[model samples]
Target: MRQPVTLSSRGFARAMRADATKAETLLWQALRNRQLNGLKFKRQVPLDGYILDFVCFEAGLIIEVDGSQHADSQADVVRDRHFEEQGFHILRFWNDEVEKNPDAVCSAILQAAKGRG
Candidate 1:
């Protein structure tokens, strides 16, 4: 079973959800409601001081919608390593990709979750 989230992390997650990006909002619409392969996904989930854009716990997957700020980001490298160390598989997509090609994004997500499913 997963550990309970700290109050601070929970609060931060809530804030992130409220302040979600356009790409995040777009992806969330498709990922929510089990619209993708009957898999459940959570948005703005907090983990180890980081808020993931979308996470499917059952699949041990983390989906990141990256904006311009994330281009060549060292912080992201570190963050990815940390999550990978904890057995989470991450899939990153550009903001424009999510907005312009949602179907492809969904397809990639579905492919990644295939192993888990």
Candidate 2:
């Protein structure tokens, strides 16, 4: 029998959250506990077959922190199209930027949330 979708997604999300990268951990601090404009963000959220780094449902915003490995990826273009079709705005930041300037990253997230709020 096939497992329920929610169970698999939740399990995967939990694993991803636990194994978060340094940049993900740094950014999560600012996003968690409603520190940014009282908006709640979920990490390692599974959506449409992709696991998003961070997502705020209220704002329909998805934040993706890309490492050097993501440079010029065509898969990203396809993924972006999927998100756009779903009416979610994606905000991407370099992993190094998230590590070095978390505050600025939070600020950008806040702005995006406000725009949708």
Candidate 3:
């Protein structure tokens, strides 16, 4: 599996400033600097031509903060399939979920990291 190159400091700071979704910000707060179970995480991470909202390489996790834009389940399923094929286990959470019940959202992510699937 090929890992994407790290972004330059300027590029990363810019990306972080770019309009981040609510769930994206919430997850980043939880995953930064070994915050969650001492696992390091990166946000707006480049993978191929796309950027994942959050990724923890140690656990092979990709967290996608989906909003109403993903109401279409069929397309989401297809997209998830592609990610799975690339050896990524994607965990999606709605914006409201993160804003209202961030504890629950983080719990789900931690569960996913433990190979709950």
Candidate 4:
């Protein structure tokens, strides 16, 4: 069974959307409005008590743009496992990777989405 989205979680997601990081903002521009192969993507979405960086429900894909703090994170491992168990494929990218090469990031995302579809 899926967990209910709590009010706090919704509020947190909203806040995250409002205070997006520089890398996130750039990626959002690339992914928003079905820009990438007409695939719809939502940012700062709340799912099963977690705030996802980007999600395409139709493709069952989740994209996470992480900072240096997420390096070797056990929490991320558990989170990725949970998402995988839920039948979602996750693609993680570093902030620098996104910032430096946005087109490459978008290409990767498109490739992943197509593979999932």
Candidate 5:
């Protein structure tokens, strides 16, 4: 069953209170520039009853930084399916991948943005 898409701006504020890792912090810098393929993106954007790590509405993209707990494939697949049904393309990066190779992560996000055009 698919849940309704819902979001509240207040949710983002709460999430921001938590400590952000280097990856999330770094990615936020680039995404905030609104220069990714010329499409504006919002950091910690709220959508579909969730607060996304990053979102490019123009591209219908959601960037998620997954910690080790995300190793569970079933949950990931289910989440992806929900977003996919809403015409969103979900991009997931392991926490280490973002912390260690942020540039590459940005590149992938850029590439995904390109796909939206």
Candidate 6:
């Protein structure tokens, strides 16, 4: 069974949502309200003890926007492995990649989502 989300985690998620990075805000504008191929996405979602950047639960897809700090992150590797084990496809894009070519990013995301379906 899935573990319940703790109150602190929920609050953290809320805070993350309110303080989203520039790249995250840009992507959100493109993905919100079923704007991207009509898929529903939730931002800053607390799931299984991690706060996801964006998730399409129906598609079992998680999209993460990362900065330089995430380079060679062992913790991220562990998190990715855990989510993959749970059958969720994780797509990661650098902050610049999202900012530079959101269209391409969305295209890739659409392709991934379609591939999974």
Model 3, position 3: C-alpha lDDT score? 56
Candidate 1, residue 103: the lDDT equals: 98
Error of 3 at 86 (Å): 2.1
Residue 103, model 5: lDDT of 84
Candidate 4 residue lDDT tens string, 1-117:
689999999999999999999999999999999999989999999998889999999999999999999999999999999999999999999999999999999989988998676
Task: Give all TM-scores, in the order shown.
Answer: 0.92, 0.90, 0.79, 0.97, 0.80, 0.97
lDDT of 1 by residue, 1-117 (tens): 355789999998999899999999999999999999999999998877788999999999999999899999999999999898888899999999999999999999999999885
Off by over 4 Å in 2: 1-7
Better of 1 and 4 by TM-score: 4
Q: Model 3: number of clashes?
A: 0
Per-residue lDDT over 1-117 for candidate 3, one digit per residue giving the tens place of the 0 to 100 score: 655565664376466648786667777888888888777788876665456778888788888888887887796787678778977799988888888998998889888888632
Q: Which pairs clash (backbone N, Cα, C closer than 3 Å) in model 3? A: none
Instruction: Check candidate 6 and list the clashing pairs.
Output: none
Residue-level lDDT tens digits of model 6 in 1-117: 578999999999999999999999999999999999989999999988999999998888999999999999999999999999999999999999999999999999998999665
How well does model 3 score by local distance difference test? 0.77
Q: Tens digits of per-residue lDDT for model 2 on 1-117? A: 223458788899899899999999999888898888888888998777778999988899999999998999999989989887888899999999999988888888888778796
TM-score, candidate 1, is: 0.92
The residue pairs in collision within model 4 are none
Tell me the whole-model lDDT of each prediction, alpha carbons only: 0.93, 0.88, 0.77, 0.95, 0.76, 0.95
User: Which residue pairs of candidate 1 clash?
Assistant: none
Off by over 4 Å in 5: 1-9
Weakest 10 consecutive residues of candidate 5 by summed lDDT:
1-10
Total backbone collisions for each predicted model: 0, 0, 0, 0, 1, 0
Provide the global lDDT of candidate 5 against the true structure: 0.76
